[model samples]
Target: MDLYTFLYDLATGPLLWISFLTFIIGSLFRAGLYIMASRKMDKVTHEHFSLKYVFLGLVRWILPINRSVKKNPVFTILGYIFHICLIVVPIWYVGHISLWEDSRFGWTWTAIPDEWADYMTLTFLAIAVFFLLRRIFSKDIRLISTFSDYLLLVVTALPFLTGYFLSHGTLENVSFFGENMELIHMLCGELMLILIPFTKLSHFILFFFSRGATAVEFGRRGYSV
Candidate 1:
């Protein structure tokens, strides 16, 4: 009914504990793996590990030509929109707004305009699925996309599906603070957040290394990889 109730009920479950542990452990594993792989990649390529590339990649996330995804702008745009939606809606949701209120942000569960937030969340959910379909159906993408790539698409889609179900109150019995769909959604999402720092999704984190790998691989021949 109110913020207190939401917070009180939100804390009342193994969901939080399991989600937190999964997140923390998954994150550490993801980070460790990425670091090890990156180091290995650098040594193999005889390329120096530089934060400059990382920072540039972060900045370039806002731009179009990634040098990595440049060969496929349509897919890149779809991927970008989907990911941007993922970032925007979840952290800005009404549930998260509770934390903002308890803090000094002068915000609360009521802060985010619901329909707009819902739209942002759903828009990306649809686009993300579209991207997955494109990968499956498109001749070029299908040829190059790996099993891991398809798995990644599916993994990313699940949170959005549950999220859409939650956002739209589409479940049989919708209760944001209850130990129901919201809890399941939260757990799955936390798993994603935790896995992010470790998986090929870490490619999102290591865009520079990814780009630079291509850049250098082709730069030697005077072309962008």
Candidate 2:
């Protein structure tokens, strides 16, 4: 009947089920395709670990995933910070932290607390937004930016902004718009989870594509080998 009740319903009922199913299906589909594609690509015996790097079955991902981006240390580190915070904060937030603690490897983390969560979320969201805007407004990035690239950022960013505002009760009160903001935020969040494994965001899950691609191209061209 009210905003909180509406959001509570979406968060608890249909959206949760749909989100879970979508995540499962989407993850499997993306991982399956990536495996098949990597296998199809010509192999190099010189490849380290003697594996197809299925889903970027590489060492960087095996580690901190920032190794491959060493060429640009600042950007890479910031990227890592942004990603870890983006993921860790939400999972550890008061809203989801208990479920995560119960269901996920007995894992526990210190959350930023509610108001601070809003602050951190807004700060990180701003950084991500700035990065996206930088890519958009710059001539070089604009040229290199694919439609999927921009689209991915759009999908990823909207939830962050909306959720941050919702959590803060700033731009959109928890009771506003029939609780549409919360539903919109949760649905977008679900969409992002379902979409992540398939998109370039998959890079986080599969950085080996870039490394393997780089290795093959360079070796074939007699460049960096």
* Winning candidate number (TM-score): 2
Q: What are the RMSD figures for all models against the true structure?
A: 5.8, 4.9
Q: Which residue window of length 10 is worst by lDDT in model 1?
A: 48-57
TM-scores, in order shown?
Answer: 0.67, 0.70
Write one digit per residue (lDDT tens) for candidate 1, span 164-215: 7766668745455344666557656766765665567766646644665544
Q: List the residue pairs that clash in candidate 2.
A: none
Error of 2 at 22 (Å): 2.1
Query: TM-score of the candidate numbered 2?
Result: 0.70
Task: Give a tens-digit lDDT track for model 2, residues 66-146.
Answer: 345667666676676677768766776876666567753566677667776676677778778877887889898899889
Clashing pairs in 1: 30-198
